[model samples]
Target: MNIGFDGKRAANNLTGLGNYSRSLIAQLAGFFPQNRYFVYTPKIKNHPQINRFLSIPNILTELPNVPGLFWRTSGIKKQLLKDNIDLFHGLSHEIPLGIHKSGIPSVVTIHDLIFLKFPQYFGRIDRFIYNLKFRYACKNSNRIVAISEQTKNDIIEHFNIDPEKIEVIYQSCDDSFKIASTDQLKESVRLKYQLPEKYILNVGTIETRKNLLTLVKALKQINEDHVLVVVGRKTKYADLVNQEIDKLNLRPRIIFLQDIPFNELPSIYQMAAVFVYPSVYEGFGIPVIEALYAHVPVVAATGSCLEEAGGKYSSYVSPFDHNGFAKAINHILDHPKVQKEMIEKGKDYVQRFNTEIISKEMMGLYTDVLKLHRSQHSNDAQLSTRPQRSRRSQRTSKN
Candidate 1:
């Protein structure tokens, strides 16, 4: 089978969707060597347009210069047809409009329905366009892959998609995230960034969705003598977060380690006394799994999918409850027994997201969709090819 992937997000630098796309694509190539996989991305600066998988003979990468042109009018459909793609998987949830018109089975991974769940968090035009495309994808997609059970439920409740149409394929973390010695990279990162020795880490973009302001406020409330280190790119909310920290006089305690190397991330996670993620929303909390694999204690928000991700392993607090967040942190800091228990449970929990399992389930989904499509097509062809009764046989047939 020939499979086409919409890999627009593969160009993004160290974001959640980018991580998901790269990891899933690499594993898909590894698991399904018999099938040909083609990844398509619009040309942009620094997009890794090369296929580095020398071992995977069937995987290929194609980058077309489609950034400035309108996607709908770019003759993309004609190109896809020329490739003879049997299945098209829109990993980014933006399937080219009218893809199903080509009579190819298309599946989309709707990682989350957050834009609909939290409309106030998005800009007006973005909200409008996202909802429109999302609805189209939901209606036209043959199989909708949700990253979590919570996300599947959200799709059903908000978009009213049939439950049978949705598949819950949990996201997996990279193998590099496990506990490792950071002694070499630690000095380099600390010296370059002027980072302190001990800190609580939070990894994600500095956005309103991350709820970092609440974490900052709770940081002030905690009496523990530890720095709060955040690893992510700069964003609009970083300025507001800085202002909030200034007002709270936490300049000495809060540090932003921007754009740390991915190789050294496990080292950072290993060194953390704890990793606190107070995100207001997440489709599948990847950081939680990474921290779990690294044996770091986790404190997260109770209001969203982290509950499902964290399971019994991590401490949770309502996103709005500053005091509760502080207390939870203190509880972990004060109790070694609780920390040990959490570490064990977290390790056990993350086993569910092993890369091999995720890849195998995805392959199963693709096979199932392909079989279903062929069965439907065969039935339709048989119905159309049925012989019509002759006009002269009307009297004989009646007799």
Candidate 2:
């Protein structure tokens, strides 16, 4: 089978969506090399990661023959047919407007409906556009892949889509996060970044919904010397968090890092005393999984799908409960036995999200969708060709 994927994020983004797109495509290609994979993008970026991926024998990347603002919407329609794609998966939340008419089954992955769930974080125009595109994709795609059950439920409630149409497929982290780094590598990374000897780690975009201030508040409650290491791009909300840090006199204890190279992130996770994700919500927290795979104990907030990522072994607390977070952090820090158990259990649990497992499940979804589509297509063709007779002819035959 020839599989096509929407490769916008895989080409451009360096964050969560990019990581998911790159990882999923690589896994699928690696596990099922018998299937040819085509990654379609409106444009391309020169990144070593993308170059390495394209070097695969069975994987090819394509761009529009004619460039335009609306190329991704419909321009790729002709190319998809020219390439004879059996199926297309939109790695992000959208597919071309009328892919079904092209006779190719399509699936779209909806990461989250955060814009709808928390409208305050989005502008009116952005929200309107997101609602329009997301609803259209959910309605038109042959199937939907939600990164988490929380996202799946949100899609159903907001888009009024059939539950059966949506599949909850957890995303695996970049392969780098899962590999074990030696102590020398960890020490090198520590020296390069001037990291604190003992620090609690948090990794995600510092945004309002992520609730970074909660981490700051939680840190103020702990009497230990362990600083907080926040490694993500900061938004305007960072200013408010900085104010909170100053108000609490915890600025000296906070470390904000951005633009860390991808190769070094695993060591950062490994060197931390504990990993904390205080986000109020997520589609599925990849950082939590990254930490788990790194053999670090995780403490993330409640009120969303984080528990699913952290698994039952990790600790959780209310996003607003500074005391709860502080106590949880201290418990793990002071108790080597508890840390060992959580780390061991988390490592075991994360195996469910290993590359081979997720890739196989995705291929299974693709095969099932293809078989069903062909079966239905065959039925439709038979109905269209069935002989028709007038009422008089039918009466004469009956007589």
Q: Tens digit of lDDT per residue, candidate 1, span 211-278?
A: 89998999987865889999887788899999999999999998888767677787788878889999
Report the number of the highest-lDDT candidate.
2
RMSD of each: 2.4, 1.1
Full-model lDDT for every candidate: 0.82, 0.91
Q: In candidate 2, what are the lDDT values of residues 2-42, reduced to their tens digit?
A: 99999888877788888899889888888898899998888
TM agreement with the true structure for every prediction: 0.92, 0.98
Q: Candidate 2 — what's its lDDT?
A: 0.91
Error of 1 at 7 (Å): 1.1
Q: Which candidate is the best by TM-score?
A: 2
Scanning candidate 2 in windows of ten residues, the lowest lDDT window is 45-54
